[model samples]
Target: MLQKIIFIFLLVILVSCGQETQPKPYGELRLEYPKPHYKLFNSNSPFTFEYSDYAEITPAKKKDWYNLSYKKMKANVFITYFPIHNDFNLHLKEAEKMVYEHTIKASAIDTQSFSYPNHNVFGNFYQLQGQTASNIQFFVTDSTKHFVTANLYFNSRPKPDSLAPAIAYIKKDLEHMISTFKWK
Candidate 1:
């Protein structure tokens, strides 16, 4: 009788467990961004660049400082201008220092040099990969009287895999801005 009861219990357990165990498949997100449209950023700040229509340029608290806010993307491109006044190397160091601050969280840092001799716009673009506070930081200077540095910051926490699409989208805009940058 006991053996019969045990057999019945085993059968019930086996029948109840009918589903096979399998690992869940990874998910991929399909995100699309609109084609970029640029507007000339001719300001009284002694510099001009063609910024994306998608962004709204707002002046920062300080003079000659501006924020290119991307409301839809929850990001901002901060532009800081400093008249060299014999401190060109100081400004350059500060910009580079800002980029290195994220080294602890960055998987890698890629540097790209850009030059538009016609416009006297020369700069270094830094792209930070991995979970970092800022993904991109760059500085453009004519190597004399005018120096400008910019940093791209997202409102959300850094998640490289999830943010890759948005990063790529904004990166193109930055490239366009750099290309059209002029010191006036």
Candidate 2:
């Protein structure tokens, strides 16, 4: 009787161990953007990143000027460009106003800034807290070269506790791009 009980326990453990415990893979996201232009700035900042091998970077087309201009992504990453200016602070103020006006349901606020004087680069990172989810806006400028503002929004509420990993990964790449930013 004891031998039979031991045999049954071992059998159950073996069967459970043999069962698959891994999650099924998910399908890739879909996105579309205009042409991409691969122009390099003066800085030596690296743009290395890890994502699915399926993503393609195309040139930013002339037709898509001022609208959302970006390289194709498996995810929806809309990048729009405004003209670069010598007075970057004014541009940042304008961006804040735009966010406040567009995101009517949210209370948008500037969180912090990171500056690199050696590269003449300055950036302000903002957080928009809505009734539901939150959004992020990054306003960057190379005082003598280029001015840029990037806003990232998603349907889900922006919970820092849950969104930290993805945000950190994307921010690293974004910072690389901003650090190397320049004007034609």
User: Best-fitting candidate, measured by TM-score?
Assistant: 1
lDDT (Cα, tens digit) per residue for candidate 1, span 154-177: 999998988888889999999999
TM-score of 1: 0.86
lDDT of 2 by residue, 41-160 (tens): 322222112222222333344322222222222122334445555666677678777567647666546477788676666777666654424356676665554566666544455455
What would the TM-scores of all predictions be? 0.86, 0.47
Judged by whole-model lDDT over C-alpha atoms, candidate 2 comes out at: 0.51
What is candidate 1's CA lDDT for residue 137?
88
Candidate 2 residue 66 Cα shift, in angstroms, is 9.8
Report the number of clashing residue pairs per model: 0, 9
Give the poorly placed runs of model 1, Cα more than 4 Å off. 1-26
